[model samples]
Target: MPAPTLRLPSGDTWTRAEYEALPDDLPVRVGVVYGELVVKPRPRPIQRRVARRLATRLEDAAPVGWQVDADVDVLLDDDEVEPVELAPDVVVYSSDHDPYERPISADLVTLVVEVVSPFSRRVRPSLYAEAGIRHYWRVETDQTAPAFAIYSYELDDATGLYVATGVHHDRIAVTLPFELDIELKGVREPRRRRRAGR
Candidate 1:
């Protein structure tokens, strides 16, 4: 049998309030895209590690008056009745952007990064590009090998889509938003933790 659909007041669509009211026990990460709830399973350890490491590097290299953060909601469209929001793995915005804001407006965002999970590989980059974010990075990890592929993009104003600016395997050097030199080789596999009783 197929899973039951969630019933919203607007039938097929939901407002930000409705999305926020979802049960706290939900097992997956949730966001709203064109009023539809988009769900993806929680990130595995390696994914979290990659996001954390990259955010740290970006924060360390970010220019003064800029901020780099992870897993923060961004309001792409502010339709009062049916909004669109997404939480990229990493987001860079001006230091003056308030953290107290419910959903950070996309206009304040300079760059958004997503470490490609199986689910995000299909949807996120294009969505972010369409929202007119200036820069984006999609990080792809190898399943069997300890390596990662970093695809960098810059917004194409004419097409409202992202144009690939660079693709790096072991390292990345870019001068946009800020000068950044990221070492991808270090973000390969997550460190193993020892058992408590071992």
Candidate 2:
């Protein structure tokens, strides 16, 4: 059987009211990605769990006038295609945010953490870098060794692209607005099975 289809109106810009009127039963999320109304799959359990852990870590480590949110929308433009929804597993925004809604810009964010899913590993980080995000961490939970591989991007003079400056394991600490440290070893992956009767 074929999956149900969603009838998306053809255009570049859409109002929040127009976005809301789409069918609620559709299995897609309507968010703007680079000025287009993009529909993407929702995150799975491992992804959700990673988000929770990162949020907790931030809340504990962050100082006053800083806040964190997960699975929230961020408006990159005035149109409906906001470029980033389902943003950061953990995102740090300035103190003045509306209680009911996500912020409009990726401004004043010190850290943006992404728990890289199998399919999204390559593309997601690049998107974040393009948004002028200062720092990003890519967590890989699907490795044989099961480790969180960290990557840091800094603006380069010649290339005009953010060059990866650091990569580390076991623990990671970022020094942006404040000092924050996370121990990745605390996140345990499921043990692999041995051959039946070895």
Candidate 3:
């Protein structure tokens, strides 16, 4: 798809009204980062696969009061001019959260997962850490293999930033987020079998 031509608001800080006024049928996914507009084309196949399957796996393993979701907008910052609404690839959140909120509030969120895309190789998961979400995971392809890897982080309360927890490849077994021990390979694309030794 061609890049959508846009005449976005010009200023240091864009308000919520300006964001809501954007065309609802845009060809790209849209969000705000500290009042600045952030847009990206939809996820490619590998990105989608990892996010969806992981969400399902997490939800299945979640404790009673927690749940997992994919592609839900989180109200990270609600500042009048610099309000932020980021939609992470996958999220683990509280089940008792109110349904009436327009976008899921940041406080209600526990963990957020992002699949590294070429367009967002350096995208800031720090935004999530700043919102006080306890855990953040980043998915990226391994340099030495065909499978993906998970780099996990825990919030550092003293610095208001995220600290590396563990890098998971074959499996994800974490204590917080409820003693998870799921195979990371399941989220990756299935390997194809060669027929007749071709």
Candidate 4:
């Protein structure tokens, strides 16, 4: 008989080494929501491609001192668990700091992006808010409705909840960090279908 795996309580803290030892494989993506583990299926090609594209855009748009990372895990301390692993599709960390194998919190990440799945939606954005991430984007990749929804928030130092600054998209021409303006059309465009009888 196989032994049951022991589960940790909520808000537990674990070291980086301990967090990496958890049994999670690629293609089946995983993240920590509070102290519990959340698994997701691997992203499709379009999603991956779009994420990469966004990374490139941020790189060019960001100021000289900023850096971008794709699908990297940002750690958040949960008392019962070693650390919460949050692997956003795209994240930006300031170049003025050194990188850690496991982040103590989502504060290391200035921005986090997720490409919405066709079926299920991952709750990482809420988790990121809990972990103190500042900016977030929820990408809807459905063929019928392709759009990127941008969200910005101010983190409460005392509460740790991110308060939304009212959602803004490319239409607003909001310039961020590196003096770069993000346009929505770059992320998506309307497709024109041709008539078969034409």
lDDT of 4 by residue, 84-135 (tens): 6767788887775565554424655677777777322545655777777767
Off by over 4 Å in 4: 1-17, 22-27, 78-82, 96-105, 118-122, 144-160, 163-172, 189-198
Most lDDT-accurate candidate: 1
Instruction: State the TM-score for model 4.
Output: 0.68
Higher-scoring candidate on lDDT, 1 or 3: 1
Model 1 per-residue lDDT tens digits across residues 1-198: 454355565566888778766654554678888888888778878789899999999999999989989998888877856778888999999878888765788988999989888778887887788778999998887586455688999999999999999888978999997998887777765568999999
**On TM-score, who's better, 2 or 4?**
2
- In angstroms, the error of model 3 at 71 is 0.8
Which stretches in model 1 have alpha-carbon errors above 4 Å? Answer: 1-10, 20-27, 144-147, 190-198
- Summing lDDT over every window of 10 consecutive residues in candidate 2, give the lowest-scoring window: 77-86
Clashing residue pairs, backbone N/CA/C < 3 A, model 4? 11-78, 11-79, 11-80, 12-78, 12-79, 12-80, 12-81, 13-79, 14-82, 63-178
lDDT of 3 by residue, 1-198 (tens): 576566667667678777756665677898888798887768878889889898999999898998778887788888868988878899888887765445788998999988887545566677888899999999996445565689999999999998899989899998985788888776896767889958
Error of 3 at 96 (Å): 2.7
Clashes of 2: 3
Could you give candidate 2's per-residue lDDT for residues 1-198 as a string of tens digits? 566565555565554545545554566645655545565567777767767877788778889988787755554333444334334566877667764754536665656777776435755666666666666666666657445566666645465356776676767676754687888665434446899989
Q: Where is model 4 poorest over a 10-residue stretch in terms of lDDT? A: 6-15
In order of listing, the candidates' clash counts read 0, 3, 0, 10
